[model samples]
Target chain A: MKQSLFEIVSNIQIAENVFKMVLSGDTEAVKKPGQFVNIKIEDGGLFLRRPISVCDCENAGGSGKGTLTIIYKVVGKGTEKMSRMKSGTLDILSGLGNGYDTSLSGEKPLLIGGGVGVPPLYMLAKKLISEGKKVSVILGFNKKSEIFFEDEFKRLGASVKTVTVDGSYGLRGYVTDAMPKDAEGKDGYTYFYTCGPEPMLKAVYKASKTAGQFSFEERMGCGFGACMGCSCRTITGSKRICKEGPVMEKEEILWED
Target chain B: MGRLSVDLCGIELENPIIPASGTFGYGYEFAELYDINILGTFSFKGTTKEERFGNPTPRIAECTAGMINAVGLQNPGVEKVISEELPKLSRCFNKKVMANVSGFSVDDYAYTCERLDSCDQIGWFEVNVSCPNVHGGGMSFGTDPNAAADVTKAVKRVTKKPVIMKLSPNVTDIVSIAKACEDSGADGISLINTLLGMRIDLRTKKPVIANKMGGFSGRAIFPVALRMVYQVSDAVKIPVIGMGGVSSAEDVIEMMLAGASAVEIGAANLVEPYICRDIIEKLPEIMDKYKIDTLKGIIGGAK
Candidate 1:
């Protein structure tokens, strides 16, 4: 992990209570698509750094200075403080968590995301499409106005499906309701990858036919794995979410009720 | 020894900045970011006789100027720690590490401590009698002077190395417990572990931490920690390794003035991964600003 001061290029509201922040910094350490950056908001009496997964990144290799794109929901004080920032350096620990493994993406891979979880999958879609693999994305939100990055994903040469529970746009109900299945009633994608609330993940886990990867979220202290504050039980016993994951292979996941 | 050096028990630390256990993991986690050999010595995660999964998710809660953690002492157990973690840590860290042990019973403490005593890399055994997150043991022993003494004596019997009893701040009388450990053959004392604290999510109408309450730590608790260190160190003959919200080089000097021989940076390290290194690097400049020549000279100097 590398700690650097990222200059905010732009901070704009992309959706209600949601933001798309573009930052320029030393992005040399950010290695993969699903990896995250922990930003220290030095205001509002916040103590711990807020961990936000990478939505997309550019020029992030070998001493390359790059720009980072992150989508965040203003649920609490930290993000609220983050949403108000116009311009200045924000201290951040980047290239954290075990990001998605593109090598595991088979020919036809499906991406499932819900709400804020939609961000990380943007870069994943870009990666898989660039790899020349057929990519299908399912973006879930509460309603139409809450939807984000749909056109962005569509422009990435992937088949995009926007699912909203209110049926205000695209398919109705959850992402699982739109899981493309073959005549054999098996999920059509060769493999699947997902990020979202746990409930949606559980539904996707049951609906998925092929093996996939799941990204997890937990309240973290040190987002780089030093503190065991974000531990969760897995098939391999206990693993720190910040270190071992924010992403885990479907086979290793042991979901907690 | 250089200006930053201080004697922790009989072991000489190049600096007094020991990363408190739990926050530093097994050392290599942070060592991956920077050279950890710059630290005097870091206390590894709180180990137990058996592997612990700890509390369920939402184990961390954010508070003003600090955070509450209910990690519940999750570790790979002592055997695996000796077999697995220490080996990984040995690769990155060259200093003699401090092993922090916690348990549900006196025998459990001795068993884990004795098991780890054979490891050469461990310079001291920090018996953690004060973990607020666990039940049946942990802070239960720490609240009572006699129970704390029993665990201290039990671990002291098994380990030949310096036994520093890590005290909890949740107690009504911190000095009595520190003195009890000293009387029971504790070579040193480390305080104040996280104070018991809780936070509630207004939206959910529930506790922020799934465990309901956890150890509150960070800059918000520095004054409470300093006061406790003053009281405990003044009461005990053994050296006090003070911690709890210690973040910067200036905080380190203040802790020493309040009767701490060395300082451990806790929640601050969570915010800044290189905080200990930063503090160790800034100590001399801050010391020079205060016209101090050696850090050891400031221990208990305030009185």
Candidate 2:
């Protein structure tokens, strides 16, 4: 992870405690599907590092070595403090966690995510389109207030579908509820990929017919695997959420009720 | 400009700003971000005899200027570190690495040090006696004068390496603990691991950390950290590595003036990922502004 003090091009509060921060840094190591950046919020104010989903990666690893984006909700003090920070500069540890595994994703694939979890899905959707793959995304949020990144995904040419819990927008229900009922019928979907809360992840695992990958959101310490502070039990054994995955295969997930 | 170096025991460091353990992983990770050669020496993660999974969730919490951690010395075991981690580290960080060894008991510390004695890449042995975050090992061995002495003496017996015993700040008498380890044959002393701290979830009526209690560090504790370091330095004649909530080069100046020969940037590393390098680069600029010519002049100059 490159800990660079990136100038904030823009930082906006999308929801109450949720914010979207765009920064300039080494975006080259961030080309993959499920990668994340560990954000150090409020200089040295917040002790623990906060991990946010990579909304998109720009400039890859070129000379400019350009921009990085992350969207997060104020789950606690870290994000709450981050929201108060107006546009200026950010000292950040970016390019953390093993993102998504794109090799298993076929030409025609399905992506699903909910709420703040939708951040990384945006990057994954764009990647699939770049690979000349037919990508479809199902996104869910609590309500219209929680919705984010619709037009951007559309601009990427990924067939994007939206869902909400309050019947406020798109398909009125959860993302799983919006899963093409004909998923088993005709569409040639090679694999499934998803991220969100544990509940949404469980739904994605249960609803998908084909094998998929899930990005698990966990409170982290080092944000690297060395701490073993973010390990979640899987079928194989205990795996570090930051290392083995914030992204893990659907088959390996051990859903905790 | 003289020897930009420090001799901790017989082991020579090109400089004095070693990256504190836990904050700096095996050095390769940070080396990938920037050149590790710029550093004096980096302390590796605390390695126990057996593999340690570390503490539970909510291991870190941010306070005013610093953060607290309950990482519980999570490591991949001593054998794995010597075999796997060390080789990877050798390729990246050209500087000597002080192996910060932590254990639950005195024997544990000795065993791990004995294992590390064979590796020449290890420039020194930093016995982790000051961790307030862990349940049994940290301040438990550091706070008690007798235990601290016993643990230091045991490790010194096993190896010829210069052993620097890290002293905790959570005790009633910080000087006593530092003096205890020094009297027991420690080559040097590192002061002020995070102080004991606690935070509450007012909304939930529970503690914020899963561990209920954690170690506090950062800008908030600099004054307290300086005081302890000053006291410990006066109490003992050994070289001291002082750190609390050091974030900038100014803090480094203050620490050295207070009597630390070197300083470790702990919570600052968590805050600014490039702090290890940032501080090193900033030190020269800071030194220039203050009309300082030698790195040695700043130590113990406070009136």
Candidate 3:
């Protein structure tokens, strides 16, 4: 809801074509895990602001300034330009979209993410673990070289598992292949939360046995609710992915065939 | 400083800047950002006789200086708009709001407009003729002068408010359509709704937008919109509301010089949420820079 100039504290390539950036600014607007920030690229040709999720945020003491961490993959001209930026300020619109509802996550929670989607879940895992909840995380990537944030997730004291498609890394196949089972040898997760590309999201959605929340990605116009550009049909009705959610409950999601 | 007030079809406005429909979203969303009462008036999202889910996902494609959207007029139907949406809007906005209506047939337009006419807060009816006519072999109503006139005449009969025909830029003869609307009883005109455009993804080897084609608008389309506004304003005696790629206060003055009595900021609102407020604040300074005594003096000044 607030737009301010955020100074890039550091920007580094964490993995192949993937970057982790730390921004110093007024991070008060970012309230929850799945909410995103819209970065306006100063490049002459690029007019639309790029939306990236908040990986983590902390109020750096009582200086009234906080630091925001975001992870992005160099997908196109905007991200490519973002990758080249070394230092200086970025005009960022912070605190966008409805984040995940942690109240729904019961005693034992399962968190799933793929590739760049892993960033948002990092904050969610950290929050849930701090709440005295047993948290398990499954990180999905294409290969060993593309993997990121496993050690970071582990540092939060959550049981972390890494899955790769080519068998070049941890468990072979997708994140769905590495799901944990309960004491009865059934789907053990009390509740699940996920963020990733559509194919992987669908895979996790099909594999999950408990009530969960899914974070969706869409090509958005206004990273808020004004433009109905990013609306999707749910079981209840159509909702704006940028506003009503980047997160929706499992029962309401009506996946398009 | 000179006067900023404008009279559109006998209705007075505090200023000449109005947020275009689909971008403003009933005024409450932006009202959360800043006081929307500062605006002259805003056009709400396009409403239809029946509820429309709009097009499929991937409805937006970013361009060089603009973007293309195939949102397809997604709305909760006119009844829901009047019952649910307008009540919410009334709490935030005190000014009379423009109601933008779209439909598949003439009766559909009339039915929706007639319903909206009963709403106390509605100041004007912007009939979007860009919708494809269901009865006319799927041709867009705005592309044909006869159909555009027919829609204008039909909506005018049912509404007490001024009927401003919102025209599409996809047509070949823009002036003829504008003139036809004026002749058929359109009280005013708002020109250059998004231009028809598309973008393809090289990696996916398919159209970026699921609808394949969408209406394009942004700062990139400013010159084209100015030219169309100039042409249409000359052809009709009714007031012309120009929109397309208008972002700054300078662009507002330029649109007025090109013959628009007022201008709507469309895509720019998406880029910066507080853009309209920023532009309105910068206008007096820009007016001083250009040595313009009054905003109304510059309407059609270029012509």
Candidate 4:
């Protein structure tokens, strides 16, 4: 992981309580699409750094400098403080967590995301499309006002399907309601990747047709795996959600009841 | 040795900035960010006789100027730590490492400490008797003087290394516990582990941590830690390793002046990641500003 000061390029509210923040920093340490960054919001009351996934990135090649785009919901005091800031350098620990493995995406890959989980999938979708694979995305939101990045995924050359629970916009169910059933068909997805609330992830896990990957969320201490505060039981043993994964393959996931 | 160096149980540290147990992991995790040899010596993760998965999810809860964690001494057991963690740590860290052992029983503490004592890299065995998250074992031994002494005497029997009894601050008399351990042959003392604390989620109306309560530490606990360090250091003759929310070079110097021979950076490492290295680099500058020549001279200066 690389600790660097990221200059806030832009901070704007995109959806209801959701924000898009652009930071210019040394992005050389970020290796994969779904990897995260732990940002320290300099607030008097806050002690722990907030871990946010890299929504998108522009690498400076070998120069070791770049721009990072992160989307976060103002959930607590830390993110609430982050949203109020328009400028200033943020001490960020970049290139954290084991990101998604794009190599496992065969030909036609399906991406499913819910709420704040949609941010990481944006970069994952970008990587998959750039690799010449056919990408299909299903974005989920609670209501019309809560929806975000619907057009951004479409602009990345991925077939986008926006789902809302309230029937406020697009399909009137969930991301699982949009999954194509046949895995062997020409249009069927060869693999699937998902990130969302635990209930949504569980629904998608049961509804998925192909072996895929899922990104997880946990209350983390050190987003770099040292604290063991975010550890969860996997089939193999215990793994830190920040280190061994923010992403795990479908076969390896042993979801808790 | 350099001016930053201080004697920690006969083994001299390059500096007084030791990263506390649970915060530093096996040492190699932070080694990915910078050379960890710059630290005096860090206490590794809390290990037990049996491998513990620890408390359930939502083990961490954020508070004002601190965090409450019910991690409950999750580890790969003593065997895996020796076979897996140590070998990985030995690659990046060249200096001796402090081993922090926690247990559900007095025998469990002895077993884990005895097993880890065989490792050559271990400089001190920090026996944790102050974990508040666990059910019956951890903080139970620390709240009482006799139980604290019992665990200390049992662990001291197996290891020749300096046994630092890590005391919890949740007790009525922290000094009594420290004195008990010292009287029972504890080579040194380390306090305060963490203040027993809890946080309630406003939305859920339930505890933020799944375990309901956790050990709280951060910048907020520094004064309480310093006060306890003063009291414990004054009560006991052995070296005192002070921790609990230590973040800066100023805090380290403050801890030493309050009677700590060495200070451990806890939650600050989670916030800064480079805090130990930053504190070590800044110690000399801070010292020069304070007109202090040697860190060893400042021990208990405030007293």
Candidate 5:
């Protein structure tokens, strides 16, 4: 992992309390799709850095120079301060947490995400499609007002479907409710990848027909894995969500009932 | 040179800034960012006799100027640490590293320390009797003077390396525990480990950390650390390694002045990944500002 100063190109409110921030910095550390960046807030009293996943990254100025995009919600004081920031340098710890393992994706892969979790899967879907893999995406949000990145996901050439809890948009109910059933005679959706809240993740884990990968969210410290603050018990053993994974295989995760 | 070198027990450190255990994972992780050989030495993650899975999720809680963590002692155990972790650490760091050992029992402490002593790269055995995350072990051995001395004596009997008993700050009288360890043949002392603290989620009306409480550390705990270091260093003749909420070069000098031979940086490293390196580079400038030429000259100077 590397720490560098990122210049905030823009911070815009896309949804109700959600924001989309584009940053310019050394993006070399971000190798995988689900990897995150730990942002250090320069406020008076906040000492801990806030962890946010990489929404997208591209080499902007040249081969070594690039810009990173991240989506965050104004959950507390840190993000509230972040929402007000227009243009400034942010001290960012890049290439944090083990990202999604795209190599495990089969020919036909299904991607599922909810709310803020939708951003990481956008990059994942893009990478999977680039590899000549057929990709399908399911986006879940509370309502139409909270919906975001639907066109962004569709622009990447993946078949996108959105689900809302209030029936205010397409395919009302949760993402799990919109999950496609297994076809009888053919190998449908050889593998699945999902990122969302704990309930959604657990539902996806139970509803998935094939071997899949699940991304977990936990309150973290030192997002690079120094502090064992985000550890979760798995079938193998306890794994740090920041180190071993923000992503884990379906078989390895032991969900608490 | 402004005499940055420090003698902890018999081992010499290039500087007094050692990254506290659990914050610097086996040294190799941080070495990927910078040349870790520039450090005095770092204490690797807390290890135990058996591989521990550590506590459950939501183990961290952020505070005003600090963070609380109940990471427990998540490690690959002593055998794996010796066979796997240390070899990777040796590749990046050429200096003698400190081994931080935690256990559930006196024999557990002795067994783990004795095994770690065989590693040539290990300079000192930092017995962690002050971890608050674990239930039956860790802080249980540290909270009481007799238990702290018992663990210290047990580990000292099994190993020939310098033994520094890491003390917890959650106690009423931390000096008594430090003296007890020193009286039981502890080569040195390191304090204060994270203070026990907690936070509640107002919406859910529940504790933020799954463990309900965790050890709190950061800039907020610096004064508490300095006071404990002063009290403990005065009470014991053994070299004291002061820590807790130490983030800057000035804090390092102040800790040394308060009677610490060395200081460990914990939560600050989490906030700024390059903090230790930055502090090391800034130490001389801070030393010049304070009109101090030698760091060792300031040890216990405040006392």
Candidate 6:
């Protein structure tokens, strides 16, 4: 419930309609692997809030205060306006949604994401690396132009693999295809963490050599649980993607019907 | 000091902020995140007799300063709501929660009312009559004056609880609709639900939402809501709960001045979870700066 004026530290358009924005704010509240922040792009009436994934939370960078970094794609009016914003403070509501559970990530951890879904993987990759665990990322995009942050994931000290629909990239196929095939059926990875479109998630769920975590995306009214705009069925029952999780264990995830 | 108490149908709301129905789900979900008893009463989701699955996929579409939704009255039926949801909601807030109910036929309205009659936890009942997504329910009974009165009469016969008729803006004459509800024994009126809107994808050349048409709610619809509330308040005798595109504290004051006794924030809640609380706190400061004493005197005051 902490609202602060987050100055835009940096913004980079990784791909068309896809941008990565870094805002300087109190990054303490948001301290999870798969959490989010609700950003109001326009100052005027009806600044329709958009939910962006927490890319990184910097505390001791230059000043010890803190800075919240969010990564999002320009989907609609809010995101489009957010792209035009340059080095100004925007009212940000951070520490939203139940983030990823890192305790579950075992010795060998694998992360998979498609397009904008790749943002949360960066945070999870950092968390996994800090714990002295082996981390691997299989990044997927429609084409080479849509691919982003391939080298960033590598910098986290994890094995990063890139895949593209067109043959202009590394694996030149789906992330599931790019998965370490030699390690399949060898109990190589304890858990699998993934985020992307419903189709991509379904494919990852199908291709996984082991059970772990999967996140779902839905049309959200409130990024919090108030609106009930984002709900997905799980093994237990109907759970809110924003509240219960935007990231859930693979065992708990009830794939799209 | 800020005047936090507001009377909706002679029932005092601790604060003026009432969470719009369909937005707040029985009050338990948000109660876990924050204190529910902090500011005001929360209006539970719309309930009918039979359970509904709501509209098909792509029910919502983003607009310029707002959104359009076709959520077709998805609920667990009135019986389950009274027996289940009410018990859960009582643990969250001590305030008498407002029940936002909907029905299809004349019998549906009466049946739903009868179920909620003995529930002391519910102080007021808002009959939602402006849902454009429902075929024979929402706007069907709203547009016609006779149909509006008939539903009001049916509900009044069953429940001693105060009834507030939520009127839709998708009508030719809103004044007539407001007057009809009051004449038939409604205790209050909630004006200006979403306006009928449609958006098309230029590239695909198809409707943006799965359902070609949807109900638009957001800051873009505020002016129309204000005008309708002004007209209805002048025409009717009951209290009016105004809504539609209310995002900020200033918008709440504008709705109150335009004729609303208490404003229900719809799209604004969709934008920010804490926005209603934000507006409620800032309201008094606005009132003090304007040199206003009571909120009652400002209703229908142009300028």
What DockQ does every candidate get?
0.84, 0.45, 0.87, 0.88, 0.81, 0.38
Better of 4 and 6 by DockQ: 4
TM-score of each: 0.98, 0.89, 0.97, 0.98, 0.96, 0.90
lDDT of 3 by residue, B57-141 (tens): 7999999999998888889999999999999998999999999998888898899999999999999998898742122311388
Ranking by lDDT: 1, 4, 5, 3, 6, 2
Native contacts recovered by candidate 2, as a share?
A: 0.45
> Looking at model 3 chain A, which ten-residue stretch has the lowest summed lDDT?
A180-189
Model number with the top DockQ: 4
* Model 4 lDDT tens row, B178-217: 9999999999999999898999999999999998989999
Candidate 4, pairs of clashing residues: none
The lDDT values for all models are 0.92, 0.79, 0.90, 0.92, 0.91, 0.80
User: lDDT tens digits, residues A1-257, model 4?
Assistant: 88889999999999999999999989888889889999987878887889999999999223566999999999888899899999989999888988999999999999999999999999999999999999999999999999999999999999999999999999999888888878788768999999989999999999998899999999999899888999999998889999999899888899886
Candidate 5 C-alpha lDDT tens digits along A69-123:
9999889889999999999899998888888898999888999999998989988
Interface RMSD (Å), every candidate: 1.0, 3.0, 0.6, 0.7, 0.9, 2.5
Select the stronger candidate by lDDT from 1 and 5: 1
TM-score of predicted chain B versus true chain B for each candidate: 0.99, 0.96, 0.97, 0.99, 0.99, 0.96
Model 6 accuracy (lDDT, Cα): 0.80
How would you encode candidate 1's per-residue C-alpha lDDT over B1-303 as one tens digit per residue? Answer: 899899989889999999999999898888887899999999999999999989887999899999999999999899999999999999998889999999999999999999999999999999999999999989999999999999999998898899999999998888889999999999999999999999999999999899899999999999999999999888888999999888889999999999999899889999988889899899999999999999889999998
Model 2: per-residue Cα lDDT at residue A17: 60
Model 6, C-alpha of A13: deviation from truth (Å): 3.9
lDDT of 4: 0.92
What's the candidate order when arranged by decreasing DockQ? 4, 3, 1, 5, 2, 6
Candidate 3 lDDT by residue in tens digits, A114-158: 999999998899889989998989999999999999999999999
lDDT score, candidate 3: 0.90
- For residues B61-141, write the lDDT of model 2, one tens digit per residue: 656665667777778899999999999988987767889999889999999999999998987899988777677776799
Error of 6 at B13 (Å): 3.5
lDDT minimum window of 10 residues, candidate 3 chain B: B130-139
